[model samples]
Target: MSGPVRSATTPSNPTDASDPPTSLNPILRGFNPDPTICVVLASGGTPTIFFLSTSTFEYFPGCAIYTSTDLLNRELIGHALKRRSQIELRTVKPGADSWASTLRYRPDEGRWYLANCLFQRYRPASDQRIFPRGFYVFTDNIWDDNAWSDPVYFGDPGFDQDLFWDDDGKVYLSTTTRLSDRAPDSTQKDLAIHISQMNICTGRTLTPPVVIRRSPHGIAEGSHIIGRNRIYHLFTAGGGTEAGHQGPDAPAMLLRRQTSFFQSLEVTMEFSTQQRGA
Candidate 1:
C-alpha cells in the first residue's frame, strides 16, 4: 500500500515522499519495510505513538513519531531519532550483512531495544538461504541528547529473531525458523512462528526454542500485546509482500493480502485476526 510520506529531512538529495498527488491506496509507502509501533500514555491524558521505518537496503533506519488523542490518523511529531539513526546507519551495516527488523520495549529494565535480523547476502530478494541471526540496538533518549548507543550483536538463535513483549513485564522472540519448500501441502512450514524468551534489556536470550504457529499460507511475522477498551489485543500482520518478491523480479515477496488490525493472542492461538489461519 502506498501512502503519502511527508519528510523534512532527506539524506543528501531529498526526494519527495509523494510524486505530484497523494496515492489512492497508500498502505506502507515511504520505503518503510519493518515497522515498529508503540503507544505511550503521555501526561495529561494524552497518548503518543511511535513508528520506526527502516530501509535495510540502504543500510539506514528511519522512523516517524505520531501522537494522537484518538488512534486514527496519528499526528506526526517529526521523525523519531532521525539524526541519531542516520549517523548510526553510516556504520551500522558492518561488513556485508544487510539488516531486518521488529520492535518492542522492555519495562523491567526500563529501556527499549529495536530487535533486528541480519546476515550475509542478506537481501533475500535475490536469494533466501543466506540469512543469519542478528542484533539489537538499545534505543536511548535521543530526543534530548541527539546521540546513540553502539549496536550490540547478540549471537545466532539458529534462527531469526522478532521481538514480542508479553503481558507480565516479560519479553520474547518469534520468527520463521526453517525456510523450506518441501511440504505434503502447498505451504508446509514455509512461513512459521517460533517462540523464545528474550532478556532484550540485557541483550540476552533466556529460553530454548519452540515452534508456536505454522500455516500453509503463513503466520504473522510480528506480534504485540496492548491494552484497549480495558482488554488486551494482539496485533499482527499475516501474508503480504510485493509481487516483485514472490515470482518475477524479487524472490522475497509472497502473494497474499496482508491482514491488519488487532486480535487476542493472550493465552490461546486464537485471533479476530484480519486474514489468517489460511
Candidate 2:
C-alpha cells in the first residue's frame, strides 16, 4: 500500500500569495507508488494529454495507468499488464512484485512504452532474490484496456528499469546492478547504475552493458536518461530511498555524458533527498 500524492509548483513572484499557485496534497489518494508520468502534445488534430503509471507490487494488472489534461484531474484509462498472459505472480514475494516502472511516449514510433521488472522466487542457497528479467510492453491505443502488447523481455536483472530513445534513433536501457554482482566482497545493498543499447522491438542488447556511475552513498536506482541540445543527461537517486537515513548524501544526483553518447559521464549536480513510501 502507498500514501497520498501531492505536487508543488513555484510562482514567478515569490511574494505573490494573493492568487498563489495552488495544489492539493494527496491529489490522488490510494496505493499508487513510484509514479512515472509523460505528456503528449497535441498533434494530428489530437488534443494534448498527460499520461501516468505507478508500480503495483504483488497486485494484479501490474502497472496502473492514468491520463489527464491539466495534470490535476485524472482518469483510469487502463493498465499495462491486464491479461494473465502478460505476467505471472504466483511466485512473487508478498511485497516484491512489479515496482519502479517507467511509462514514456516514443514520438517516432507513435506508441507508448512501459518498462518494468518483476522480483519473484528467492534463491535460499545463495540468499539472493532473482529478478525474472526486465521487460517492457507497448501500446498504440492508450485508452483501450486490451491494447497493450505482451512483454518483450531483456536479460537485465535490476530494478527501476528505464528506456530512452536517443536522437539518432537508438534505444538505450538503464537499470540498477548490485555492487556485489561485480565485487563479491561489496555489500549487496549497494547498487550501481548501468546502461546498454537495446533493440526496443526484440529486447536484444546491441552493446555490452556499461557501468555508468556508482551510487554516491548507500543505494542508487530509478535512473532516467534524456538528450537535449546535443547532450545526454542521466538522473538517479542516491544515499537511500528508505527513511531515517535522510541527510546530505540522500539527495538525487544529476550526471551528464561528456560526448554525444554514453562514453563518459560526470556528476554535474545534486538535488533533494528521497524517501521511500514517504
Candidate 3:
C-alpha cells in the first residue's frame, strides 16, 4: 500500500478461532480483486466456478466472466450476459457504449446471471430525459463457452449489484440505489444491496427490490454464503483503496455476515484489505 499500511481480518469476532494451522493459499485471487462467485453443480455432482470482471476500457466497461476448476486458478471465459453489454460512445464525447456490472447464480436452474449497471445517456424523441437502467443476463454452462440470455431491467438507474442464494433453494439480490442527479464533487454515494427472488429455472428475477445493506464507504459487494448443517453465514467486504483518497471517494470493502430468516447483517468484518496504494 502507498499510504499508511493498514490491514485487518474480522478483528472483533474471529469465526474459526479454534481451527488449526494450514498452508493452502486462496485458490482464486488472480487478476480479479472483488469477486462475486457461484459454484455451478454440473452433471454427476461436480462444481464449477464463474465470476464477474470489471471495466477494461473507456467505452467498454462490460463485465467479463471467468471459469475455474481447482478454485484457486481460473481462465477468462467470455462476456457476461448481453444485458450487461458495453454502452456505445458515439458522440464526439470520449465514451461510447460503456457498461457497469452486477451478478448472481442459480444452481438448480443450471444458469449463471448478471445485471447491467453500466449507465449511459440518451435523449428520447419527445425530449424526455431518461438515464439508462440496469438489467439481467444468464448462461447455462459456467466453465465452457456459453451465451448470455436476454437483458431484463431490475433497477431504475443503478449499478454495483450484490447477489446470493442459499442451500434451501432461497434466492437474494442486493444492489445500490442509483440517484440520477448525484453531486459531481459530493463524493461517491454509498453502495446498496437489494434482496429478491430469482427463478432458478428460467433465470429470471421474480421479486420486488428490498433494501438489505447500504454504506457510505461504498460496498465491495462480492458476497458469498458459507455455513454447514443449519448454521448459515454471509461473507462481505468493507473498505476502500488508497489511490482514490482525494479524487473519487474509495470506500473500504466492508465484510458482513448474515442470518435469521434473511434478516440482519449479524456479523461485520473483513476478509482481505488494501489500506493504501502503491
Candidate 4:
C-alpha cells in the first residue's frame, strides 16, 4: 500500500511541443485538503483505492472518503465520523477541527484504519488545557456508513501523522516534531521527523519518540513511510506551502533506511525545478 511521493508536475502537451499541457481535473471539489490514499487488493486480485481528505473545522462528519477502481473516476463513499461521540466540534473554531489524515488497511485484521490530528484549544467543558491530539478509528467494512469505530485518542505527534504497518506486524507512527521546543537556541535544526512504535488497537505508544530525520531546508511535515525493496522510505514535505516561499526550492524530501528503522543515517533527495527565471 506504500508508494513513492506523488509528483506535482504537469504533463507535456500531446498535440504540440510549443503548446502548454493540461493537468488532471480535481477529482473531489470543494475545501477538501491533505488527501491520503490507499490501495486495497481484494481476494480476486482486484485493486480498490480509497482516499481520505481533511475536513478541517467542518461539522459532525469530519473526514470524507472516496473510492475508485480505475484511479481516474472516484465515487463518494461516506464520511468517517458521523456521530457526535466520534468528534464534537461545536465548541471548536471554524478552521481548527481536524487536520491531515491518513488511511491504512490492515490485511491480517481485515479492517481499515484512519488516523487524523485534531486541533483544539482547550478541553471540552473543563478548564484543563491540552495540545493537539491525534486519534484513529477503524472499520470492518468501508462500504458501510456506520461501520467505523469510535475515536481513540493518542498522543500529540503534531500534524500530518501517518501510520506504517511493517511486514513483521509492528506498527509505527511518523510525524513532525519541533526541535526548538527541546533546544530553543540550537541552530542544528528547527523541526525533525520522529517515529515511534504504536499499538494501533489501543492507541498507545509502545516506545519513546525517536528522531529519525532532521529537516535541513525547513520545517518538515506531511510525513509518510513506505517499505520497498527491503528498504524503508520516509517521504516528507518541507519548507512552507505558500507561494514564492522556501518550499519552491525543495518541496519534498525522501530518506531511505536499510537493515534497521532506528538508524539515523539518511539520504536526502531535493526536488528540482524544470525551468528557472523564465
> What Cα-based lDDT does every candidate model obtain?
0.44, 0.76, 0.47, 0.69
Which window of 10 residues has the lowest lDDT sum in candidate 4?
A: 1-10
TM-score of every candidate: 0.56, 0.84, 0.55, 0.79
> Which digits, one per residue and each the tens of the lDDT, describe model 2 over residues 1-278?
22223455455466876655655556565778888999999988988998999999899977988777777667776678888788889877686778789899977768999999888753445655465688999999887769999989986678889998877778889988766555666554566788889988799888878887676564777888877655777777666565624645444556564554566677776654443333
Q: Report the C-alpha lDDT of model 1 over 42-131, residue by residue, as the tens digit.
A: 546634445444434434334343333333333444333334433344433333433445545554554656555544343345333454
Per-residue lDDT of 11 in model 4: 39
- Ordered by lDDT, highest first, the candidates read 2, 4, 3, 1
Please say which candidate is ahead in TM-score: 1 or 2: 2
Error in Å for residue 157 of model 2:
2.4
Q: Show where candidate 2 strays beyond 4 Å.
A: 1-20, 122-127, 180-182, 244-247, 272-278
Candidate 4 collision pairs: none
Best-performing candidate as measured by TM-score? 2
> Per-residue CA lDDT of candidate 4, range 124-230, in tens?
45422244668888899987769999888776456568899887878888876665355644543356677888887777888888877666564667788888555
Candidate 3 vs candidate 4: the lDDT winner is 4
lDDT score for candidate 1 against the true structure: 0.44
For each of the candidates, the C-alpha root-mean-square deviation to the true structure, in angstroms, is 10.2, 4.1, 9.4, 6.1
Evaluate model 4: give its lDDT: 0.69
